[model samples]
Target: MEFKNVSVVKEANVYFDGKVTSRTVVFESGEKKTLGFMLEGDYKFNTDAEETMEILGGDMSVQLPGESEYTLYKKGESYVVPANASFEMTVDKYVDYCCSYKK
Candidate 1:
């Protein structure tokens, strides 16, 4: 997907020792999103706002809040994480994703 008339943060939001990295993108309406990629590994992330994660490329196994097991999400798929919740992800190799936060 392409973003138009938006501002992107130069510095990345790096996590898991750089295994996961994302760049913040700010829209004209003050909506914010992160475009990022994850290398092969397991990761846990906590959310302050509700988030919709769209898989841009590759795939991931995600365990959402209160979920007992991981569910596979492939390219062109998306998942939501509730506000103030945490989730886990397992990336097989590399997964490209876009995360949009609900205000």
Candidate 2:
């Protein structure tokens, strides 16, 4: 099964590694109901999807343009980004995760 980028996706300066290995995951695909995964070191997170959920892993801070801002998602935690709002993220270590949408 292939995961389509049903939503606009993009990433910058994203990396992943644990002690002795590493990889780069900057992906985007949208045409069907989908899930996107990415590994980022320290970068900005932006989205325009009606709702976006972060699933899997990461220890980063989420920045909203105004009123609300925070970092979320890791192992069993997740978050939904508000529509029409832009956000950003930063991390100390490599972060891994998947995004899902109903577009």
Could you tell me the lDDT of residue 25 within candidate 2?
31
RMSD of each: 0.6, 7.2
Say which candidate scores most in TM-score. 1
Writing each residue's lDDT as its tens digit, candidate 2 over 1-103 gives 3333434334333334322122223235432222334444455545666555554454556665674656555666666766666667665554555555445
Give the total clashing residue pairs for model 2. 3
For 1-103, candidate 1 gives per-residue lDDT tens digits of 5899999999999998999999999999999999999999999999999999999999999999999999999999999999999899999999999999998
What are the lDDT figures for the candidates, one per model?
0.96, 0.49
Residue ranges of candidate 2 with Cα displaced over 4 Å: 1-41
Deviation from truth (RMSD, Å), model 2: 7.2
What is residue 29's positional error in candidate 1, in angstroms? 0.4
